[model samples]
Target: MLKLKLYSIICRKYKFVQRESIRSNWMKQRKRTTSATSIANINVH
Candidate 1:
């Protein structure tokens, strides 16, 4: 039973880390896209 509890805790932690990693990667991608669009707009002027 104790081993099962520990396994569940580790699983939850791993899921949390995976979600955070995905979020950070998404933010980085969004920033890059935004900057690229702004540069394109500036070039149009």
Candidate 2:
């Protein structure tokens, strides 16, 4: 019972960290794409 409880706690923490990393990565990608598109638009105009 104790081991199961500990395992669940660890799994939850790991999942939280995994989610945070994914979110940050997504934000970085979004920023990169927006900047690139803006630059492209400036060149076109």
Candidate 3:
């Protein structure tokens, strides 16, 4: 029973970490795209 509880806790933590990594990656991709678009606008002007 104790082992089952520990396993569940570890699983929860792993899932949380995975979610955080995905969010950070998405944020980075968005930032890159926005910067690229801004640069394009400046070149146009």
Candidate 4:
């Protein structure tokens, strides 16, 4: 019973970490794209 409880807790933590990493990566990509577009707009103007 104790082992099962510990395993579940570990799994939860791992999933949380994975989700956070994915979110950070996505935000970085979005920022890169936005900056690129803004630069292009400035060049056009």
**Largest TM-score belongs to which candidate?**
1
Per-residue lDDT for 1-45 in model 1, tens only? Answer: 999999999999999999999999999999989899999999999
Q: What is the lDDT of candidate 3?
A: 0.98
Question: C-alpha displacement of 38 in model 4, angstroms?
Answer: 4.0
User: What is each predicted model's overall lDDT from 0 to 1?
Assistant: 0.98, 0.98, 0.98, 0.98
Candidate 3 regions off by >4 Å? Answer: 38-45
| Model 4: per-residue Cα lDDT over 1-45, one tens digit each | 999999999999999999999999999998999899999999999
Return the TM-score for candidate 3, rounded to 2 decimals. Answer: 0.76
For each of the candidates, the C-alpha root-mean-square deviation to the true structure, in angstroms, is 2.5, 2.4, 2.6, 2.5
* Clash list (residue pairs), candidate 4: none
What TM-score do all the candidates reach, one by one? 0.77, 0.74, 0.76, 0.76
Model 4 segments beyond 4 Å from truth? 39-45
lDDT of 3 by residue, 1-45 (tens): 999999999999999999999999999999999899999999999
Task: After superposing candidate 2 on the true structure, give the runs of residues whose Cα lies further than 4 Å from its correct spot.
Answer: 38-45
